[model samples]
Target chain A: MINYKTVNDNKCLVIEISEDFIIDNSDNIKLKDAINKIESLPEIAEIDFDTTALKSWDSSILTFLNHIKSHCLKHNIAFIKDSLPGGVQRLIALAEAVPERKGVRKTEVNRSYLASSVAAIGEKVVNFTKTSKDMLAFLGETTIAFARLITGRYKIRGSILMPIIRECSVDALPIVSLISCLVGLILAFVGAVQLVIFGAQIYVASLVGIAMIRVMGAVMAGVIMAGRTGAAFAAQLGTMEVNEEIDALKTLGISPVEFLVLPRVLALSIIMPLLCVYADLMGILGGMIVGVFMLDLNVMEYYNMTRDSVSLNSFWIGIFQSFVFGILVALAGCLRGMQCKRSASAVGEAATAAVVTGIVAIVVATAVITVLCNVMGI
Target chain B: MLWGFKHLDIKTASITLKNLTEREIGDIKVPPDLTVKNLPDSMKTPHIIVKNITMAYGDLVIQQNLDFTVNKGDIFIIMGGSGCGKSTLLRHLVGLQKPAKGDIIYNVLSKNSDLEQNRQKEINFWNTSAEEQRLLMKNFGILYQSGALWSSMTLAENIALPLEAYTDLSSSQIMELASLKLALVGLAGFEGYYPSEISGGMRKRAGLARAMALDPDFLFFDEPSAGLDPVSARLLDDLILELRQSFGSTIVVVTHELASMFAIGTNSVFLDPVTKTMIAHGDPKYLLESSKDERVINFLTRGEGKQIV
Candidate 1:
């Protein structure tokens, strides 16, 4: 364990960090508090992070030091870590990158953070593609396995289908419907707010009809499923992968794709359409809520406008897009699971990757389809 | 250890699968032609020769220049450190992974060749179809370290999974066979239970039952004793030895458990951590007692008191 303590000398304030700082979170907190105190005191000029008393410290304490540096920069106070250990120098350098007294705006900070996250996501996607060949093979093999499963041969009348429906489909409906309804209400309300300024409040019904049928329903369904079902699938398969059950299947000549991936892919592919249908209905219902209660528009008037605006082709296109999104989400989840490293942490990471990748795929697909339809004058 | 004991009663927490009667277990009597002890004598031409096979992930070389032969019916055990490529070697054997640099040649015998060729053909029939390969593997079973039973399936369903996939048996017949397997693994009455509902040891047993479902000729185990307490591990080790004696199947085990190594490995291969090479290969007792190799000596005699690196 490392400990750190700061002493106020006549010329300089000395901060002593105990070696047990690595094991002690309180030490870090105290260090931060001390830094905060020194920064607040106008008399203090140079602050020395006294690592002579330091025994051990993890990278986390370095981050806390970074916090201190930031605080010092805020106050135009110079922070010195001359006694800092070699291990924490890099962190200090990184934290010290920002100059003193030139703070970023909140929006700029958010955008920079967003940009870094996006870059990280891009790197992950590239990395995923490297391992994707094996995953593709696994998926192909799993597809074959699923086809075999559906041959009506492995019927023990066992409780397989119920779990699929309960866990993957039926259980997901209420939440899916609820989220879709909320999204619809928000969209309609936003449209109403904008159109009422132009004396076109009634056009909000048409906007809701077009958006729900073409974009919102499928996109929202895909995003939610990516968050919910996609994560579940990855977690399930990842747990199996970590447990070596997949290897057991391989050794038994039982293809994991057939045994594990197939069922999940099939379940997701089948359940996705249902989810989309539910989403579309609920979104329209939400629109109806806004139309009647919020927008002061009658329910029948809203329905008639929706009916006029939404064609069978429009509805079908949305449904078809959702179906594609479902497959992509399922594939992304399964791929992540298949690519999962043989560890518990790997499983968790794979599950998170599944959801993230699924949402990205959804956004890209939705954008492409929307653009394509606009170009074709649909 | 107390936590292990506390988990013993977990089997009764959920729905249990039906067990098969003693008479219903499928009888498979196959001779064990592949014992590691008889590798030099039995292998006229090595089926799979691993010579100086070096494998690494990034900067760390898991195994290097490994020299070994896997012949028909050879129950080979590869023992090493945690990340020492024991599992990687098994993956190579199963053709799931290619070595970093090594040749794995498979001898194909054609039917139209001469008399000697005919004999070779008789010894080895070639089939390219995946289904055919699967059918051949039907005679093999694999028990994983973590006892990878399917979470969704009941114990009975898990055991019966292979039969359903490859066989034409009715549900009743599959259940009966599955029960027999369950009984063999001491999971007779717990067939309907899901993997989540069962204890770890029971799940391992269940995995073993499922592995044996196809009546495989070769059985592969990866860290069979991992994550288990001494008592459960001992029970599992005993079970492994009993199966080896009774079934006479080719058992390839990848484990570093010294107790398990000494107990069941008739012949074993010692994988060195530093060299990433096979330091010794022979009977465990002989290698431990007679080998002058420092690594081998240190590895074999190192008691459980020393923590594994």
Candidate 2:
């Protein structure tokens, strides 16, 4: 319990803290009330602690005392703690021994909602312009690195290239296969449901084939690689930056773009189309499984229909989209990583940003290619 | 056949007896007429022996043929010119970077243990398995130049992390120990603050608190005073000396501060960037007074033209 009474003709306020003044007790309201009473008294010249009845205490009691101490300091009231226990006095002394460091606390500002919104929008616009400029700079650097690689100037070691190739291509197979096959199966089943009613169930093969070959397969692979390899590249490069390994490479006159980014870009670009083709085959096979078992169509008949429905133009477009997606994912990941601040948390933010950027780029590229294909009658 | 066996003190005799059981007394070879009076009052125990380590980063040799010994309970300073691989050598000693050639041997025997146990207990740091290396690393407390605290955790949580991982103490007990460690570094009430919330000097002190969390035997500090003002830097030097006096921990500090070197360093190795090797090794004060190497004198006096007398 906490109780306070004014003495010396209301000139001094004495606070009494008694039994079980620990953190567990719900006596905060009492403390707050006492503080309010002390604040209201204008003529009070001093505040004192009367702890003769105090039996037990902890950090909670210290915190309570600290609140009053701050209030007394603010009001220039003399704080007398002579009645408190020796241990409590010493703890209070220890806590105040190192003064609260100047300019360490973050200053909070209150602003109108409209003003805050305008400020936020201004910050976003500035950030967007900065990000765009950085992206263009990274793009130019990558182009130069590519030119050097083509002209027999920059040689990428097999040690670095091989691991990245394996990571984005071979290691990505299981997830890509699963997602593409599921997309094909869902397409086949949904088509079969409607075609069955119209007595055209065999059309499910063509429906699944055209969709998978033209876009679904590559899209699924792109999303999977974005989440897997893109995030990984960001995390790897971001950690290298944090460890000053990238700076070390720079100090040695080796361009990080050429040594680090080029290998990753080459690996991802070369593997994405191959993975996309493999994903197309897996998706067609998944469609066949549905057509043969679920729709009772002959396996060879379904395969022949798929071959007929998937045009060369659609297949080439899908490959091209996947290649572009690969380059985009790699660039996005590396760009975010290179831009990362030297902190542990920044690595995580970079990885997340890489995934988001990769996925968004894939979807936008898909949209533009679709519109172009329609306009050109592909 | 045991020449000094008769004059061996009780402690030394017991150690000799312990070794005698391991090896035949006839196999024990003692120097002629070696007596307690002639023997060293206390032998310097080699805690770490760097044997001809050549540090390199892919074809670029930073330092070569580097050999030194860090003795037990010694504040060993690794001082050199900027970019002379002083921090690199500390990294090698702490097992962060591998040496291009030779080995780093750690003597695992306690300071007061028998001298005969040195060879038997010696461990090749690089040759150990990953698990063994991790166990060895547990005894080391490293303070990086940037005070690399886990930015996400509060000072108390950062100090409590190793305790939580390696000990079975309750949460409250760990927190209390964390507070105690913070208090030792004069950051008593700043336990709830994050690393970014404090000043640079405070962050360094907090880093020291985290380093001492497990009460490690070896404390390695990289640039303990690089970013601090003179007053805080001096206070830190005093804190380091106090830590050594109280805990008797072997300290390896990578610093170029002449004041710090003379103030606390018991022994040191002067690394030469030009030669890519150490040019001098001994007590820093003694080296300052007696070393004939011009580079050593130039470095020790901060190139202010104080030649050896």
Candidate 3:
């Protein structure tokens, strides 16, 4: 028997197979409807497939269940496949015995395991604390060195500031602005499509406002900055390290981190906030166009909706996220720079690594923050 | 002075002595108006001291206990076989590596007379400060082995980089300085060219101009004539010598080319790639004559150039 029911205020569509059968062609149009209905109720709690009643299910049934679980999972629901019947349990055990699927789960387990292993490897082979201390010490020294540089204690003229600013800030503006507008347009289009179907066309403004101020603006700004600016920082410093320019700095009584990484980090940190603000304006404007033309909403109405929907707190939160992302980009860039080996190939590797690492960090941070804020009812 | 010398030797892990007494070493006479003290302020401090330095990267050892003094107004050279660690030793001097087993003391020379203050300033000056470091880097210039000028920058922009980064000079002033440096290097009116637009020799010259932009006192050159034709190499060697005479700057060059070595190396260090050690020091011709080391003899008297089959 396939017992399908709505649970937790229709927040979840639970499809339970609790019968002993092969479930051979299991063509049920009603099951598809049940799955579709789950999306209508956004308060999805849990999608529990208590397969304990299932005995000797067919391969197609397993496939359908897996597909359903994945879909529910995507909609932000917990897909729990609880206690299984003997035959089904035996089949699952046998599948786990297979090499490929076994390795898949193994890898899933191994990822977290490997992350923890870094601590172990760092502790056993390397002096974890000492290495950390040294890194921190290096950063500290770099900070002090940079402080001297700014105060002219090292006698560096105001002249050096211009090139760094030009390269790090001014040169980055065009790319940042262009990418922000595109991101805004994309998000607006997506939000308009969904809200239009519901005849809540004016809600497109609210969608764009909330999404841009909460996620897209800061995230896209960060990603763009990482690609354009972060990689540039890494490549610049990486090339210096490989070509001995960094060493030249050392020999000139200059700190490589202070002279190189500090300026980049500071320049990026200062610019990211402004970039986020620009991105927010562009994204909202993009949504405004979609709302006016496609969603049949007036531009003034859209603007008022956006203003009413998004709060300063949300704006601040987005900025905060972008600030964190900016710091991460710089940190990753600088980290890549310092880690670069002295070779031509190593410089390229560091640049690519900085971009990849920066993007990945941004995504993970966004997900975690979004989930955390949701849980906090913020 | 003796203790300091010991420390210096232990730190640099390498040395080059004239060995013929100070009188035998001929000094090139320059125009009296050019004083060594007027060299770029970048070289005021002894940022790095490489003494008796022995370097080995993996299995490739470049030099051992090689002693050399890189003082203000000194233009130094480390020349050897193709596999020799001239570049490696140069890398070591710049703190790319910790000496396998020696000291590479890096610090600015402080003008303050107090020992503690001097030490603090030296350490702090080298340790903390981004702006100062950039100016200092601007103060010193390097012509890379491949003339690794940024591909994105124009010739004028490339030359103007140091000036832009470290000087308050306006764009016009930067342009003037860049053009002047380019002219000095014999590449006038090539300001609009990119690295790809220029010939290899011109690129190297342009690189040299960039290095000279900050009016640096210490210049590090790696095989400045490596891939150039012999005529170009000779011209570069002449340029190196002229730079010394005109600027009174300290230059450290890494080259294995015999012609360039003899042409511009007033004092030199010879590294043996095989043993990863400095088997000879002093004038190139003297190392050829007075040294009992067979490697030195064979290297000096190989009769043919590196191109000989």
Candidate 4:
């Protein structure tokens, strides 16, 4: 609690602060009233602090006293700080030791929403162009490096290449298999339901086979690699960028792209088609399990129908799509990784961007390839 | 003093004795009348000669007209105010970034040859071929400010990577050497820990271990004492001193910490951000006592209120 009184025959204002003047009790104190009283009275020559009755205190009391001190300063009245505790006086002195720097605080600027939106859009367009130029340059460098490798001028150690291949292909097998198998089973079940309405449940074999071989199998593998391998590649390289390992490599006279990115891209390119083939076989097996057991079709009939429905043309196209997807995934992953800023959060954002870019590239490639195939009447 | 010589072996003591002046030997109350011509061969040779280099990022010049020589067995300190391109200067020396102007010449000798047979040969760093640059870089070990350990690799693997890349050492040999390097940095039994698994101090030690994996001729440290407690920083300084004493590797450090600067620095160059060039270059202690530049005196006697015009 705080109380004030006129002292020395109304010449001085004695402010008494007492009993737990902490943050919790700050709301109860009427600092405004005290300020108003000081302003109203012109005869008061000085203000004296009286905290002798205070049981305990904190910054709240210091702030209250500071407010009064500033008011006294403004009005040219004497603020006798001798009556306050030594700690309080020292703290006040310490707080005022250094003046606040100029122009440090940010002032809010009001602008129309349309003006702000247009500015933001212009900034985004500039950023997009810059990013595109960087990506094109990276692509050119990678291509030159790949050419160097082909001519046997650049030698990549087997130790680096082998591990990357194992990571993207062998280590990725279980996930790709699981996802592909489930996709095939869902397609078979859905196709089976419709076929049963026409008393043609046997055609479920053709439906599952053609779908899995033509596009679904490659698409599933592409999506899986995009999420799994692409994200991992981005995060790995992004973290390396953040740690200055890339700088270390450069100083060590090693090209970061050749030593790091090339191996990853080569591994994914070689492994994706192989993974797609494996995924296609697993997906067909999954459809067979449903057709033979649930649909009660003869195993031979289902097998023969699958063999007839899945043409070599479709098989080659599926392989071709997966190859394209592999390159796209690798490019997206490495692009994001190389573009990563030197920070922890940038690594996470790079990984997210890699996955987004990889999946979008896969979808767009799939759409274009399908349109081309339709135009060619294949 | 004799106390400083207590830990020195007889060979190093003799070397130290050859270089000691009357004042240095005065601490032991010894008469300095002996002729001193038997200095170590490395003492006279300059390891790196950074001649009039200008560092910049595009057109924004960080520092210009920098010239210094790092003698072998010298713990050279690139001392300066913050943002004065001290780290950038180290980067230029280490071949991470090329100077916009001027050349850095490295005086290297073949590893197996005797000192008499293989007099130091100068290799202009920037003008050398990629292969020659790689070979030159093999003899340099650098500790970055943030440790920069490969987060994906275990500490053991991080140290072993350089060994594996540059040496034909077998896996077992590489592992043993990696463990030995880790033990040297007082990080024994931490071989299995990844960079992210350890504390910042531990990671810095781990980075030091990796840098020393090849036992490079020159060691570059960018703020080795940063983000460390006073006690830890002191320990790091002692470790750096011990490494220099044991291996005789020429070390270059970039830092602003006065404590470590005074503790380990044998020679230094003070870069001034305002001037975009170095204002003082000499032994930091000597600079503190006798330098006429007010900025140098103010920097050395910071927080002591002893600013002299």
Candidate 5:
């Protein structure tokens, strides 16, 4: 066991610890409790340990000595270890050899809500600035890549581009068509309520046609593609980053943007308008279905009204919006992928961030384009 | 588990119900570590026996009819050119892969399980129960090539995880032991740093610290110097030597790094792809000086061993 003596009102506390200070023995229990008790007393100005009897100790004696050392360091108590074995002394010295490095530990202390909020806002502003700079740099690189493509200097492997094109276009068609169709149907139904009150049920077709052709079809498709294709792109490139393939490309003197990003972006941009036209067709059909079945309008009449109401100008506007959104989604996904850290979980985080960024870019582009469309009298 | 196990019939031995305490096991005198080239001594004292092992995938035999012995406290190297089933053999040794034909036996000298009586009946690789496997595993510690430290935890936390899972130590005690292990690996002040924050060499050392956390008797290193610089690799070699000196734990390293192979290796097995079995088996240094196989010579000397000097 363990023996302790209190001299001069605990100013000089002597702890004598002995043989086989293992956890299995009942000695560890008493020593553990005594160590904690001795450690807490502020009045104990000095601590001395006797460990010559520690014939075979595992973590128990080490734990006890560590406590005594740290307690002495904390309370400015003089720790005398002349009575301890050389090996135990050396072990203690080894464990305490390096004082903890400064600022390595993440310290979190309670702070006022206002203070924390201000700090958070400041951090957000810094992060926003950094992201803006990164986006601009990415755009510059993309512009250079596009210039190289126009000059026919950049290599575009048909194999890589073809699959991406199919995924972003053919693979995305069903969901995009379904969401756009539902959007058109909802628009028709809501417009029918007001149009019916005014005895102008035919104008409901114009409302559905204009809304779906101008913005609804493109926006719905944009959201769908952002969640589907953009996230896939990010995950793919993020995995490439993890495997150091992107670095390998750079080492081989081929720009990752020119080799990997350009093909994907170009494919998305090319297929986007085509998909929008398809979305527009699907949306008009959905509206036609809703009108003929729910509004007692004849199918031929509904078809004629839709054909008359939707202008080529509105269709072109929707196509242009979709093209821009496709570019933004590709850019957002690629940028996030390039920014991915070299770790397995970073790939997943990059994919999630890509989806968020893609949708945000689409929404923000929609707002800007809508204003520009209005001003330009599109 | 203690080490001097006697084989009765080389087949099976009944588990004796003697309650052998840790103190009693510790009192058993371990045979002094001698030169591994002593055949009779080593044959009688095989710490781990790879008996008639045949590693395969489907119909493809990676290596067949492989047999080897690793003695106690030996720094054993499993050396081969890339893709010669060296790692496959290591996987079999560590209980990760099942041998298509044979079983690996660890002759843990434990009295309670009557482990010594039947030549490793307690931990008969594929035949033993899951609990028996876990018990056998407690005596082992493996360090992967990538230093596979948990990315999320701090260095100290990663080291403390095994301690927390297996031991009854308090939080403060665990932290202290973690620091101790880290200090042992020359990573004293890096307790709070994440694996990502440290250099690749430091990460490997931290992994070593974690492996040594349970104070395991069998320590394994897989390509420990695969990605390390020369200085760091040499430092790792020194660390391995020190670990053997201090703890005297049996070390099994899987590497083809020649400098490391000749430096710390007390015994080694050379796996050849063409032969699809061990071409050479003996002490690495002894094989380097005496072995006559051309392939083995080419491998040992980094070129043609016969031609070089």
Candidate 6:
């Protein structure tokens, strides 16, 4: 809403700003146009501001005045600012108090695509090595903490262990049951499709039972726990880190690994084999449901077939894999949480990383256990 | 008449400026507890009155029976050691947290009411509805200790946010205002820089710039010099004084820093952590010199290398 009147007062150029000098883009355009006009005017030797009628102004007016101040300076014209308000004078004085440092402002540098790509790859490589080293060191710390825990030398509140065990077992049962059942049904359904072509549709029982007992139950339980319990563990510890609660523990002569990580790892490792056995039963029941209704098989016959298909070694192998998986998931979650940077965003990233790392560790462990069992003729 | 919604019958500080001259602010009859001798008389008006205030978080009471008058243009210090509820008191005053009991009345200059009658209409700031609380908050601004600048936004964008949300100013005008405010705090030409890109002291200055963007009648700073070197802290202190002089806004600072308490504080309340209540109330320097309370004397004289002058 700023309005200016240009008066050539014979000796100097007086641009009198009147009304509210609330400068926006329109005002900037007009001011630029005014500057252009002044450039064309050879008779104008000096620029003086006349703001006697100006009502109220803010930073926009300051920027406008600053613009004129610079214009006069660049053109070797004398600039007078006595007519402006006292606040305006003080403000303009403050703006020019410190000059901007040279080379302080960021000016983008041009680089070749090849150079940038190479640099990025080099940085990623360094990061990968550092991350692997850090992870190995964390594993060593966890092992020492576990050793101390086994010796009954940990500082963890003994009261916390019971609740954590309950969480990983009892609280996890319903979801584990639901997923295992659905997975069993899918396997039966898929096996029936192939077995019907050979007029041996009853072989679907053997397929579902053997798969659940040997590998599927443990893999499913591991993946579920990785997403469920692992994410929760990471989030809880990451938040504790952000709040400096973990630091408080450390300063109070308590090791974070022993007090926080040891119990979690132990609880999950102890409960996961039990959950896998429970999951194996649920998966077999699911296979029985499909066999009884869809395939027109009697309940007793399907049950007997499933019992014959599942051997002691196969069941034990699955339980062993689940036990290892429990350790891996808990370790991954706790490690990422403890390694978190002290920020809200870093806590979120830690939780996400924990889930990814937990699932990856589970898959790799499953592959190793399966190959060892196959090669050793278990 | 700032917001001018027929229901929102609020008069802003700017609208009621001329009426302040007629306000009987000079005759502040100091209660016995607040009387500290050898204090100068000036143009300070009672801005906020906290009477019989009890602040608590759920069941735990932080401070009790708090009664104090914060005057206009006064740099009031809420001084105490750690965990003494200084920040809690600030939160209560700013309406961020509700007091457990009693009233926080804003003393405003009534337009047509008599000077004495105007005291009756002093709005109860503590128990207002959410809408009215938001409007009432416009009279004051706060600079949190962390410099609570939105990390996602650049300094200019951060400063521009409140202006954009409240005012109908054009984007270009807002940007210009943002630059001017930044320059006022010696952050000229750094408008495009994000908070993470700036130094700690610069971020604090940027926060001060945002706090001053509204030119509120009152400003609250929570531990303004919590993490800064001596030179930066001194510069911040000087800048605060300059801001008070220029904007003429009453400042309420919650800090335990003795240097800042001595440097710019005009009035102060000493809250004792152990006593669980305010032990002293007056000018910081005056209390340091004349207070008879052992705890007050000890706290005020802590870490100073010499005896009281």
Q: For candidate 4, what's the TM-score of chain A, rounded to 2 decimals?
A: 0.87
lDDT of 2 by residue, A71-184 (tens): 889989999998889999999999989997788799977889999999999999989988898999999999999998999966786756897899898788888888888888
Better of 2 and 5 by TM-score: 2
lDDT tens per residue, model 5, B160-229: 8667656789989999999999999999999999988999889899989988998877888889999999
Task: Report model 6's interface C-alpha RMSD after superposition on the true interface residues.
Answer: 15.0
Rank by lDDT, highest first: 4, 2, 6, 5, 1, 3
lDDT of 3: 0.69
Displacement of residue A21 (Cα, Å) in model 6 is: 4.7
Cα deviation at A171, candidate 4, in Å, is: 3.9
How well does each candidate superpose onto the true structure, as a TM-score? 0.69, 0.58, 0.60, 0.78, 0.51, 0.53
Interface RMSD of each: 2.0, 10.9, 4.8, 1.3, 16.0, 15.0
lDDT of 3 by residue, A276-360 (tens): 8888998888777777777778878888999999998789889888888987788778778777897888988988998998999
Point out the worst 10-residue segment of candidate 5 chain A by lDDT.
Answer: A244-253
**Model 4 lDDT per residue over B137-176, tens place:** 9999999999988776799988998887788899999999
Q: Write the per-residue lDDT of candidate 1 for residues A72-172, one digit (tens) a residue.
A: 78877677876788778877777669765544444444458789899889989998876677767766776666566679643323355557656867888
Which portions of model 2 show Cα errors greater than 4 Å? A5-7, A25-27, A39-42, A110-119, B1-260, B263-309
Instruction: Identify the runs in model 3 with alpha carbons over 4 angstroms from their true place.
Output: A1-204, A240-263, A285-299, A342-345, A364-378, B1-50, B56-62, B68-77, B94-98, B103-141, B150-178, B191-196, B210-219, B247-251, B303-309
State in Å the error of residue B145, model 4: 3.3
lDDT of each residue in B1-309, candidate 1, tens digit only: 888766665433311211111111112121233213343442333334455567766766788877665444445678876667788887766555557776543322233334333222111112245654554456557776677787767999888878887778999999999999999888879978999997888888888888888766568887888888999889888887777677756677888788788877766787776567777776676667666676666777674222332
Who wins the lDDT comparison? Answer: 4
A273-306 per-residue lDDT for model 6 (tens digits): 9999999989988988889899999988998888
Model 6: which docking level applies? incorrect
When 4 and 6 are scored with lDDT, the better candidate is 4
Write down the worst ten-residue block by lDDT for model 5 chain B: B17-26
In candidate 5, what are the lDDT values of residues A1-378, reduced to their tens digit? 777887877798888777667766564567567767776676888887766676777766777677667767877988888788777778888988998878779989787999999999998998998888988999999999899789986657575589789989888888988888888888888888888898888887888888888998788888888899889989988877775456433422346798678988999889888888888888888888788888888888888888898889988899999999889889888999999997999999999999999999999999999999899997
Q: Write the per-residue lDDT of candidate 2 for residues B275-295, one digit (tens) a residue.
A: 898888878888887777888
lDDT (Cα) of model 6? 0.81
* Local accuracy by lDDT, each model: 0.73, 0.83, 0.69, 0.85, 0.80, 0.81
